[model samples]
Target: MKMKIQFIVLPLITLLFIASSIAYAQNKNSAADNRNAIDRMTKELGLNETQRGKVEGILSAEQKKVEAVFNEERKKLQLIQEETRSNLQAVLTPEQMQKLENKMRQEGSKNNAQKK
Candidate 1:
């Protein structure tokens, strides 16, 4: 019984986690990617110190904006997920919910490992 519930919920949670992360998961590489782009642009364009500073500022601002948008979206997603979980709590048995939660934790760890 437990294994059945866990198997089902594990995959569903994994899919949801992927879907949620899709909206704003690039921040981990954003800084490195942006820095590389800036470096390439600077070298190709031969930007002076003043121009470089302006360009860096522009890039930083853009990155910040992107981060902000994603953060906001993630928050909204989190709220929706919480509501869904709460609603499920009404339908699922406590034992089933415990198994589901454990499965989710195991999946979360697996996801984190892949990210690293």
Candidate 2:
């Protein structure tokens, strides 16, 4: 029936969207972490005082740029999530919504565990 098809297709689309978003977030976080590591390593490595000062300045500027990009990306992601939630709400019943929420929570927990 049309309702059954809608039920199946909607959840599949939602799950795929969520999975892709999470993967994108993970990639962004990984890039930030790598940048942080590089900055730390650069600081720890011995250099002339002038060179160290220059490196520090460069790192500070890079951090600000990265933070700006991150904030923009986060805003975009939030908008996408809100739009997806609204669309999914139209297609999903309360019970289905709960299931989707639980699935997201479980995925989050798994990601956290993997990070640890």
Candidate 3:
């Protein structure tokens, strides 16, 4: 029985690991696409060699700054979202909350599809 249980669990775990790896690869590809878009924009702006180097450095720094800001904002937004959800649960009817959740899920799906 233990061997049979291990056999069943092993395949399920392997499948989940494969699925997660594929998802991570997709995210990396999406980030590459975004970087390509930035590079294309930089090329179109016609910077000279020295200017290009400086611009690239500046852009890299800005990207890091923006990422930090985004991380901070995301945490704050998550907290607000949790609080709002809690308040809504207390004050809103179940049907209203369900509608809100459906709307949020739809928006999230649309955003994910757009990233792809």
Top candidate, metric lDDT:
1
Put down candidate 3 lDDT per residue, 1-116, tens digits, no spaces: 53464355434433443444445454445556556756776689765677666766666676666566655655665565567567667755788667656755565555456556
Q: What are the models' TM-scores?
A: 0.75, 0.66, 0.49
* lDDT, candidate 2, 81-108, per-residue tens: 7887787788778887777777766766
Residue pairs that clash (backbone atoms under 3 angstroms), model 3: none
**Per-model lDDT:** 0.79, 0.66, 0.58
TM-score, cand. 2 vs. native: 0.66
Q: Residue 72 of model 3: what lDDT?
A: 67
* Candidate number with greatest TM-score: 1
Clash count, predicted structure 3: 0
Q: Which regions in candidate 3 have their CA more than 4 angstroms from the true location? A: 1-50, 93-96, 110-116
Candidate 2: clashing residue pairs, number: 0
Q: Give the TM-score of candidate 1.
A: 0.75
Instruction: Per model, state how many residue pairs clash.
Output: 0, 0, 0
Compose the digit string of candidate 1's lDDT tens values, residues 25-60: 687779998889889988999988898889999999
RMSD of 1: 3.3
